[model samples]
Target: MESSKIVKALSTVMDPNTGQDLITANMVLHLKVDAPNVSFTLQLPKLDADYKQQLNFACQEAILEVYPEANVHVHMQNPAATAAAGQGSGGPKTNNPLPHVRNIIAVASGKGGVGKSTVAVNLALALQELGGTVGLLDADVYGPSAPTMLGLQGQKPKVERVYGKPKIKPLFAYGMPVMSTGFVVEPEQAVVLRGPRLAGIIRQFFEETIWPPLDYLVVDLPPGTGDVQLTLVQTVPVTGAVLVTTPQEVALADAVKAMNMFFLDSVNVPVLGVVENMSYFTPAELPDNKYYLFGKGGGKTLAKKSQSMLLGEIPLVQSIREGGDEGKPAFVNKEDQVTREAWMKVAKNVARQVAIRNELLPETRRVEMK
Candidate 1:
């Protein structure tokens, strides 16, 4: 007699195509109940007769178990067809690209611990400060740092029904929308996720998240070229990549391997520029002194090799490190004028490089899986 119970019962039925339950998949819509009489529409991925009949029978049998005398009326609809007919907002099944986002900037590195996530988070915030609407996606499945760095740890993105289909709503941090695997699983759980699972999560983040129109979407990629990087280029058209490295030869060596992935003939994503993180050390007490702790000129060297410019050199400062650990990036601390200027400079140069890339070339194509 209650609708909640009816919804719960319907949730038990599964959608074979997606490997999810009906309710979890957001397939059931417009359910009306009058005790013994239940009617609802089911949005399907395909409209094949056998597929439709199978789903319809499953729904009726599920409801019958709860109310033996119930009459169930099942209606079927296809989003792709409806959208093509001008009756829907391109239904959930349409393979529509992110036309609303002007650019997708990927922050990457050849190895870990190069401050790639720090640069990505600060760069995204700095871009927002410069009057551009931006979002962040932490695509590092194994070591998602956004949840901790963004001060959004232990929070989960909410799923809501949009156009009768379920869509994930990103968590907002520091006035920007953000998505990351850290939101769904703990660091311990992420260690076991392999190639296909990682790709599925990355793909879902793009296809299911209801991201608003954005001027730029900053994606923090996993270190080096692997499944996450390959899946990224395949899922969405990356605007460009900002390679991150330190002033060390080993880091630069590995970074070139990552850079070459974008340069490959089949996957030709443009290199935006280079960001040299941890270039030097400047103690808070001695603000005037700069000491080279990790060697020098690695950023510039990589820039020359990649045919791109050095975006900026980020010095190692206590405040910058503490801010990252505490979920308040240095770019927001007005007292750290030097660090703020460094990030803002990177952001500005990135914006300019993206503009130039878009102006001079065609939109980068999504790498097709062979």
Candidate 2:
């Protein structure tokens, strides 16, 4: 019995979680064939007894159909643990809510009305354009812009049962998975939640959402630091933050405060870079002229203070505001080459910064409660 034939047979076995074959999902590993004895390790997202038993039985039958008299031994293990072991991160840490995501980028602002959500929606799309599987989490319960910006307003994500456990299926927008409170709650209703209740909703988004494996999960945070920000740092190992601020002195102070929260000893998430939104205004007719309506160099000043790079400057273009209100994002507009390139540059800088952070710094740990 050749190993290729055994692999081919296993490929026919589907993973109910993702509706992909075991081989295609890269769940099967360590195929060791010794005559009539055939054994392999199966990577699983969940290790429920019934689910495991069902998969084990299916694997045996599939192999048996191909090569009769073959004794199949299937060992099941969590892929999350295997991934950590391979990366040399030994021992158990705080339970990570997003183990499948390589990086969690917090696109934050010091205050509102600075185009933070715009930066986030476009940044996620830009990352996808650069060949990375990305997802978006609009963590701003008070004002969830993903629904409108991604043209998914009034649409709710489906809750499906996986392995007898309920999971929230993320809504897709421009080929990226997205989760936002705007999906489930009315604009006015979202503001009624208090303290723990708010945290619980945020926790649900992190733990219950059935997000596909992604290279980056860009989280669009509410302006300023509060329950949502704290919940995020404590929930997952945030790779870094991208602070968005307008090119003005007033916004700089608020941006610094937000950046300082991440810099706290307890929460040591690195500042990837700073994005200056509305850095200048350029009318459609006067494309080459840059009007510094919001002042100059606030992004650079913030970056200098944070000891991070000035990722890029996004001009106050009419199309950006129009796109946001019209349920369409500027990043998806193919004809807008200038806006497209700007977002792509920010995404490229973010990706490079993430690579540098991962190389020079140790993996971030959850902010433990004292």
Candidate 3:
């Protein structure tokens, strides 16, 4: 069988979203031809499981029509891997496009006002506190709260000449690199943006920023499984994702969607675990009391239902709130050992999950069909 025949057949298969053939969109990747056996990979824009299966089947059918005797091996390749394969620089190459960074972790939520940003801020700090060099990217375009939480609001990314190219210098807070849309625009000003514009900004974060060598880069994604979430997963080589939700029925419902996005076959971004933020409330005056403000065990239930680790249950504490507002993440301050430990436990669980993912799965693809 000839690879040219397979390419021509792929060219006939149109993308439902773009109204263009897969070959035209450069989706057909790594095509190989062998007598009685043919193998190829598809790099899709979005990873809808049903759609991928259909596309794979259609491609196989098309190829078989021309080469009836050939056996086909079709694989879905990640965009990150495809991009990494193209770079011809003499520098050390990595499967991840972001070679300077060791690991990229995304923090996501199903809905807003679930303390997602709060969890993201504290978690980044928590990771850094655990002796890892970390960078935090606030991917929440509509609600870029990481700057305020990280105490880097109103700060701007500086441009420097690196290797004869202009590179964005990430702002540092509490000894860790930080970037956010808040840095680009005024805090109170509403960003009137659409999907493409939002995606462009996210792309800029990875490509433009001259990030130093680091252990981890924690991305704070906007709430919901919208453009920002898709853009982050598709563009960056994310190691894993952390789903944040409150112990409430409504929040858990949305959290389910967010978690499943990472679990999708095309994306396959391993959910490091689920974090139950504001799991319970502990009054400052009465430290011994526990209040189920948003109901109980929702995080644990969600984790169990999702078959993911319950990273940690963070309580609704006044100090945690105060610390975020004051540009001091509670985890960074060891004064309140209880709150510090709570956040620290989550951080450790995240690290453990990342380590497990690297050891077992290694690459982005977590599971495969037999």
Task: Check candidate 2 and list the clashing pairs.
Answer: none
Model 1 Cα displacement at 288 (Å)?
A: 1.7
lDDT (10s digit) by residue, model 1, range 250-328: 9999999989999998789999999999999999899889999999999999999999999999999999889988998
Off by over 4 Å in 2: 1-22, 33-38, 43-72, 76-94, 188-190
List TM-score per model, in order: 0.75, 0.85, 0.73
Candidate 2: clashing residue pairs, number: 0
After superposition, candidate 1 runs with Cα above 4 Å error: 1-96
Tens digits of per-residue lDDT for model 2, 111-150: 9989899999999999999999999999988899999898
Candidate 3 per-residue lDDT over residues 3-65, each given as its tens digit? 778889888875443334778667777788988888888876445675577777878888888
TM-score ranking from best to worst?
Answer: 2, 1, 3
* Pick by TM-score: 2 or 3, better one: 2
Q: Rate the local accuracy (lDDT) of all candidates.
A: 0.88, 0.88, 0.81
lDDT of 2 at 257: 98
What's model 3's lDDT at 34? 81
lDDT of 2 at 362: 86
